[model samples]
Target: MGANAAAFASLLRGATNLSQCRWILEQLINSRYAGDIFLGNLALQMFGKLHGIGDARALFHRMAQTGRNLFSWSIMISALCRDGHHREALGCYHAMNLEGGIEADMVILSTVIGVCSALQNLCEGRKLHDRVAGCGLESDTVVHNALVSMYVKCGCLDDARAVFDATPTREKDAVSWNVMMAAYSSRGKFQQALEIFNDCLLHSVQGPDAVSFVTAISACCGLKDVKQARALEELSCSHGFLETSVAVQNSLINLYGKCASLSEARLVFDRIASKTALSVRAAVMEVMLRREEKFCHRFVIAFMLPSILMWCLGLVF
Candidate 1:
């Protein structure tokens, strides 16, 4: 019976027919293994993926009658968070704590911390940080990464930096480096972000990925440093980052525009296969406006006006 329930849940995962999924789940609920914990959690995951959070919440309340396990609690919390119910997710976390038998694991801790981050609940986040330490789960790299992200989100870069510094060498993955760099970049600390990018090069066991390059290029845009931006662009290409990442290409265009290199910006812009038309257009126009008056007028008449007219026509008709 349990096997049948799991199989049904697995089938529901790939199921596109919402009505059929409902029918199948109803069949399972009427079966002998309806109380199976694994089936209940798997059903929650399927429902969340299908945007049936209302149904998932209903199922959660029913399951809570018999008492939910830790995994069940985590899934509900995660589902609530993914659906943008941050306060509800936090409330669920507290409820899980007060419910008593089940302890918080890394996944739950990470989810609640993320909720706190999104809500910017610093006092609650700090208390949770102490709870994490007391639970001896602070050494978990996943939880550590979450704490770094949470602190950064709450605008406590000092606290974020402290967490990053404490991360063991073995556990400092690319995300850890990326999050730290992002924290600095988000605050307009471009030089500090670049410095961290450089540190990633020197220290991280795993090399920078597309996200890393994009963040660093964004920092270059903020600095408006043409020389360093060009160097970074070259470095990204050499690492093959530009070959697959459209975001890196877009950032290259913005970086060159910010540095007043219209020609170079156009070169990068032309290379993007799937361009975001309006944003690219805006960047091009900003660079054109900075050029000598004669060139600017000629370029605007020859290029910008037509593109704008075309975009407006597409929207209208």
Candidate 2:
């Protein structure tokens, strides 16, 4: 029976679609292994992955009747969040707390804090923050990052910065720097955003990724500092992001356009093999609105007419 349960568990892991999962689950039930905690957790995860939330909830209730474990509760809460049921996800966490015996781990805490971030429930997020301290998980990097993100999304930059500063230097990852930079940029604190960017380059263990470059370029665009924008362009190029990431390329085009560097903007736009409508619009709008020279307007119109038509035809999305 143990060998059969292991084979069924393996099959559950490999199941791709809802149909396969349901069939395997039926097999487990017939084999009298459906109530097994480990197999039940696997089924719960598969149902969640396949968007079978209703099935997941049903299975969760059955597991609860027989006594659900931490993994069971965590899977259900995460599934609820993924399906955009943030309120329900919080409710699940609360129910887990009421049931006792299961200590909240980093995975569950991070997920529930993210639910608060999504809902912008600052009050609940604070409660969770207190809970993190109570459970002695404040030093966990994953939970700390989630707390920072929650505070940022809630429009509490001071709180976010406090958590960010408290995060151990070696534990800080790309997400930590990117979220802080983006928060400052979104709030029009462009200088602060750039400061965070510079710090990330100096201190982050894994260094910056595409998002860091985009956010920093956006801050330069806000300041209209052409020299800084050019420096970032060069840095992005050195990082090989300019040629690889469409988001970084698009941000550069917009940055140069806003800085009134039409030639630089056009150069970046011309390099994109798969230009988005944003890139096309950014390039053409700058040319049409800024350049008073009739010949330049005509040249832009002629050069961009094909892409404009493609955009109109819904082909260049």
lDDT scores of the candidates, listed in order: 0.82, 0.88
TM-scores for every candidate against the unseen true structure: 0.83, 0.88
Q: Write the per-residue lDDT of candidate 2 for residues 39-143, one digit (tens) a residue.
A: 999999999999999989988898877557999999999999999999999999999998888888989999999999999999999999999989888768889
lDDT of 1 by residue, 219-247 (tens): 88899999998899888889887766777
Clashes of 1: 0
Quote the lDDT for 295 in model 2. Answer: 34
Name the runs in model 1 displaced over 4 angstroms. Answer: 1-3, 266-283, 292-317
